[model samples]
Target: MPLARRSLIEAAAARFGWRRAYGTTTEVDQLLNEQTETAYRDAPDHAALATAKNTDALTVQPGVLDARGRVLGEVLYLEGLLAGARNRRLPQELIARLEDVVDHGHELTVLLADTVRATAAAHTAGH
Candidate 1:
């Protein structure tokens, strides 16, 4: 495809994608924040976070916050991308794979958060 065509397609993809993926700006930003926090939390523990997955398709298991201000999972960042591009004619296989990654990330994030909280509680009690 020509540069112009490609740019148009990409632009269209982003515009249409964002519209279809999230209902509003607030949701998009919230999801983005969730994803960011997961990254920050996981950085100190490389192995645990590296195990999380990613995708280019859509938002699968987006990050979630529980009552305790703990992160639940890996926060599939691309899940937001995928959500934004839901209207795009992406392949089914890609979508499925992305969904799987998102779910896996979510599970991992939750486990890691629990571990961190527990560890902190233990440390506090010991002091």
Candidate 2:
């Protein structure tokens, strides 16, 4: 039934300007808004979250192992150079080239690890 009604009493109320529309926030809506704000306000700092995130990334993610593998590759290359330096009378030019190779490999590994970490950070951040 319309609030603006045909009954004499309702007509009298409407005409007398006593009739009114009413509304209130639903409990669920109010609760949701409150809980959401509380959750956000009480949440940990972004750096803390990222540290926790990277800890997980270092353990469970395959990228960590891939990063380790790259490091190992560089270490082995450098180890060979070291062994050659100690054992054989190797050419200076050859040693220099091997040093460059190992240095480049190390740089590449660091870059790859950083990329992997950034990817993990993005995932943890819900990006």
Candidate 3:
């Protein structure tokens, strides 16, 4: 995979807790790696920008909830790209990887939201 794509993928994996099974290599991982390489080759500028944005978001966000929100926003941005891919009739395989990324983003968003809510509830109870 291209460096830009690999960096972005690593950042996302770290944020979302995506893990490869200990003993199994999955199709999703292969497809994602291939598609990200292709994507970087085709759009190096975009890939670099995305990687930078993700890195900056992680570093610059003020608090836990803010960082989560930034990640959620990045996911929404990626969904827009996925929509474009669908409209352009890109390969189903590539589209599938994009969908998986978006799905993970949604999962992270929900998990963060729940955490925020639980924290607020605890604070209220303490007060």
Candidate 4:
């Protein structure tokens, strides 16, 4: 997944004619890398929350909502990035890749939202 993410970043950089200094990383790159790693680390927790039947709803619901919010935030961020790329008149291929990334992010948001909704429904039904 990191390789795929790096390739996408490289393609975007190439499209924008961005040059990086040797042996140095930009602040923006560092932030993005950190966010990607955080998302990867949180994935297992999200899955566990989704499948947690024995856990209390009060405990699981917060995690479900938090995961959903994070994914939704990421989707929004990607949408903004895609809009900026489009405004800059980037190549169609690069634009397409950005769109694909945004779409995938949206899918993740949807899945997390579903988990949140299911948790809510189960909680209500139990009470």
Best of the candidates, TM-score: 4
- Please give me the total number of clashing residue pairs in predicted model 3: 0
In candidate 3, position 4 carries an lDDT of 78
Q: State the lDDT of candidate 2 residue by residue for 45-106, as single tens digits.
A: 96776566656443435645576696877678786866787478688776777777777777
> What lDDT would each prediction earn against the true structure?
0.57, 0.67, 0.76, 0.78
Stretches of candidate 2 above 4 Å error? 1-64, 67-71
TM match of model 2 to true structure: 0.42
Give the per-residue lDDT of model 4 (tens digit) for 5-122: 8668878898999964434456567757877998998676655545665466656777667888887888898899899999999898979998999999888888877887887888
In candidate 3 the C-alpha lDDT for residue 29 amounts to 69
lDDT of 2: 0.67
Question: What residue runs in model 1 are displaced by over 4 Å at the alpha carbon?
Answer: 1-76
lDDT by residue for model 1 over 85-113, one digit each (tens)?
A: 56685887767877777787677676756
lDDT of 3: 0.76
User: Once model 1 is optimally superposed onto the true structure by TM-score, how far is the C-alpha of residue 10 displaced, in angstroms?
Assistant: 19
Candidate 4 to native Cα RMSD, angstroms: 9.1
**TM-score leaderboard ranking:** 4, 3, 2, 1
Global Cα lDDT for candidate 1? 0.57
Q: Which candidate would rank higher by lDDT, 1 or 3?
A: 3
Residue 11 of model 1: what lDDT? 78
Best by lDDT: 4
Decide which is better by TM-score, 1 or 3. Answer: 3
